[model samples]
Target: MFTSPFQDYVIDAAQRTVLFWDVMRARGNQYVEHTAQDAPHVLSYDFEPVMAGTDLPSPVNYGLVRIEPPKGVKVDEAKRPFVIIDPRAGHGPGIGGFKADSEIGVAMNAGHPCYFVGFLPDPVPGQTIEDIMKAEVAFIEKVAELHPDASGKPTIVGNCQAGWAAMMLASYRPDLCGPIIVAGSPLSYWAGVHGKNPMRYTGGLLGGTWLTALTGDLGAGKFDGAWLVSNFEGMNPANTHWSKKYNVYKNVDTESERFLGFEKWWSGHILLNAEEMQWIVDNLFVGNRLPTAEVETTDGVRLDFRNIRSPIICFCSHGDDITPPQQALGWILDLYADVQDIRACGQTIVYAVHPSVGHLGIFVSGGVAKKEHREFASNIDLIDCLPPGLYEAVLTEKTEDTPDADLVATDYIARFETRTLEDIRALGTNSEEDERRFATAARVSDVNKGLYQTFAQPWVKTLITEEQADLMMKIHPARLEYTMFSDKNPVMGVVKSMAKIVRSNRKPVERDNPFLVAQEQMSDMIIRSLDNYRDMRDNAIEALFLSIYANPLLQATVGLSADEKPPRARPGRSPEHIELVKRKVEDLKARISHGGVREACIRAMIYIGQPDSAADERRFEFIRSLRKGVPGELEAFKLTVREQFFMLLIDESAAIAALPDLLKGHADEIEQGIAFVRQVASTGGEPSDAVKERLSEIEKVFNTALCTKR
Candidate 1:
């Protein structure tokens, strides 16, 4: 018999409440179990430890582990191994491989040996960031040693906080890394659009990281990572306080396991050394030093991102409020004057901007792994072969009508379109006045930090005992919520029994029940209210931050009034570097017409590719499949491509005219060469009129050279 709507609502509500409490009880139990296990990690795949940082000369909590491929997944040891480093910003390790479909799975599925670089919950006492860097280098070196016959150096994948870390390692030891992928990592901390990114205003509004120092001191010299986790939760108050729990409560039967699993990782907060936190705040966050090459090692070795020799791929999203596209890609503007500077330095940089994906989604989302990351892994060789310039990595979903669909190995087709500095600038950036405000904030941070260290730090350190600090961490709202709902709590025993009885007599409501619909509407209204309040609060914080920091008096006090240049000023290239660029271009100009049919064919391909300013994987794959008539390896082909590309950039007219000179002896094969170039170029689709014109020019050159030889 059908029940009344009101009776169904009462039964469903009662059952949901019991199941929700039971899930919370389960989450607490999992938290307890996870903490009890030594070296706890959330990886779904099994792995064996390779090396610990403690085994190194300078110990850290970090360790390297080799992932064992799952059933039916065969890894090719001859291929370059992949090393994935997860972010240690408040959370414990294994985010990169916590699920079957993740960064680790992508590389492993692609037949590459995979390794993970993760850290323990607690840092080795007195361990610094430099130690972690050194440990990472050692881990990569070990991987290379294990695969002596590998094709190249290990590819490094750094997610979020680890992205900047990967960049640093590549810069410090360029030869140790192959291609570098930095996903959702903020390199330029001060960059953001005015009203859209309220997080950038936080440091300034909080009086410039003084609270960070105070918290560290209160923690008895250790910085509680729960504080960082709290900050992230604070970004979306509705989700933190209401919607997250409400969704689980509403769908308790099916959503409980997933909720508990995610909470296991989320609630496992770690620790950072007070000194380490201070250095990060001083150097990267407030000082904004990494992008400008102002950071150096203890031994005075300058860490310049420009010095990295490998191809760097940046993945960011427009939907990520924490690390927006500006912060992820703005460092390019900070480092180079324009795209010419990038090419002149012999660097290949590619970036992709997702229309909508949150920061964590960039790393852990299964859909992201299947599409973006799979494409990246499959086309890594193409990325390596790309000529030194700025290119945007665009992934188009493959369809039945896609051009050259048979050539695409994956579900998506990847393309690297040539981009310019204007493209990055079009995203968004701060004005000169806005930059001045951030500069003032940085100056104020330094002053405030100094004052805390001198006056407040000593007394706080003396007053907070280790036991007292431990109690404070235990009582932290973020942690307390989990512990309070655990099995250890006497009150949860009743909840567990009640949940079991409800499950035995479960009677779920129909989808169209009036009361259920009304309940959802109420939830929507609550969320809307919370979101609006958040917006207003953020707007007020932003306005207050601008008013205080933009004050001329405060600016003058912080040594900004007399300076006409922006605070985070762009550093110009040195005379020696300029001379080096000139020498390199002159060298390429001298060798404008030097090669065989291979060089002519590559030149033709790149020449036609310029019209559309894009080249897809199909075209690149076709080029790679060409016969090795020339006595050279893949690296040789890459070098030839770069040389010919540079020749074009130096003098396009001369580079084209010299094609006949390259094919001087091979004039008999001119027709075959044209067919080859035309075939490879058409993989993307039918060529434009401009491309046809270029192809016609090449034909004329081939005919003229053939006749002259005859």
Candidate 2:
């Protein structure tokens, strides 16, 4: 007998309801189990502890562990190791290596040793950021000790919040780090477009960060990370309030495992010392000091980002609402007035913007892991060899039309294309008015914080005992949401049994059922309504913030003038820096004609490849294939490449003209060298007219050198 649509709907709905409740119960049970296990991280790979932060002089919850490569994976100890630091913003660490397709996986697959720097659920008493930095340096030193034969220092990757920490570490000890990659990190705090980036307005709407201070005080000197997670959820109301639950309700059987897996990490909220949290807010979020070299250590050393000597790679995404392209790339604009400033600092900065990935997806998404991360890991050497300047990392999938396809090692072709400050500005930034408003907000925050500390903090701290703080954390909505649905709840026992019975006799409605279609339409309507509400709320907040902080009277009260320049306006180059640049330029000029066959070959490749304004793996790989032996140690070769690149940059004409002199004694090698460069020049495709012209110039130089030798 065929049932009516109503009957089908009733039966299917009943089963789904039971299954949804069961999934929630399972999630609760998993949370309990996870906590019982002391919330072991979600890293898919097994690991052995290398060093514990607690063992250091200034103890911390952080630890460094070495990952054991999975079956069939071989690690080369001689290759530079990879040390990944996952963000400890709210959740526990291991997001960077929680699955097979992750940062750790990519490095291991590439035959590099991998280490993870993660933290425990709680901080050591009075532990500070400086202590963590010390631990990080020690961990790196240990890695270096372990890999004495490695060709280069470890490549450090910082995901999300760890991005800033890694940058600080690199700036603090540039000699200890190799390439530094920061994924989904916001270095420039006040950078965002009006109307679109509402998160930047949040602090202003809240009247600044005094609330953060109050929360830390109320928590009895320990900040509960659940509050941070709650703030993140508030950014997307539809997802937090309805869609995530509805997804599981709609596809309970298939989604439960993935949901449980993610919840293992998402629900693992850690703690931070009140001092640590307060320092982060006052120095970074509100003070906005890190980018401009205003942040200093307790010992008084300035943490200037320009001091970082290694290649810095920024990976962000357009679709990421949290760390948008503006916030990720804006610091470049803040620190350097022009590309020459970057080159003067001897810095190589590369950035990659994903077209549509979300913030977390930049680090955790499998597709990104396979493509972007993989390409980055493989082409790191190319990045290291690049000259000091700004470049964009572009990855394109290989195709049959690709030239010299056989020489390509990976499935994608990686290119580093030159970029300029205009490109970063084009991503969108705050106007002058917006800057004034943010500055006003900062000033207001300072006043409010002072008031609270003087008036409210003492009383709150005195009244809020450890027991009360513990109770408050237990009853927090974020934690309660999981606890209330667990097997410990008497009502869940009934739902659990019902779920088993329903699973045994499942009755799923067909997709075309009128009731099912109606259900989907209702869901869409609900989602739209919530999204509209979110948009309205954000707009109102933005408007309110501007009205309160952007007023001329209020700006004046905050000591901001109508003619105040944007916060990111950089001062002119220092006299000392200018002298240094001049000296470096002169030094490079003197070495224009001081290289052998290897230098000539690298310079020729760089010169010919200059027309495309890009460097590709195919060309680099072809060069490697032709070399019967390495010219020297990898470090020496890197120095040679950098020297030649700078020589070309400082005086391309002189550098190319002098190449014939350097190749004079190697007349017999001239034909082979030219052939090698020509083949590499054509690796990506048929050489463009400009590339062909450069190649002809190289040929003429080589021929002249040969004739001169005769």
In candidate 2, stretches whose alpha carbon ends up further than 4 angstroms from where it belongs are 567-574, 627-632
Clashing pairs in 1: none
Question: What does candidate 2's lDDT look like per residue over 593-638, in tens digits?
Answer: 8777888988888888888988787777766565424533566757
Query: What is the alpha-carbon lDDT for the whole of candidate 1?
Result: 0.89
Q: Could you tell me the TM-score of candidate 1?
A: 0.97
Q: How close to the true structure is residue 77 of candidate 1, measured as C-alpha lDDT?
A: 85
Instruction: Give the TM-scores of the predictions, in the order they appear.
Output: 0.97, 0.97
- What is the clash tally of candidate 2? 0
Q: Compared with the true structure, what per-residue lDDT tens digits does model 1 show for residues 436-507?
A: 899899899888988988998889999999999899988999888888899889999999999989999999
Candidate 1 error regions (>4 Å): 627-632, 667-672
Model 2 C-alpha lDDT versus the unseen true structure: 0.87
Residue-pair clashes, model 1? 0
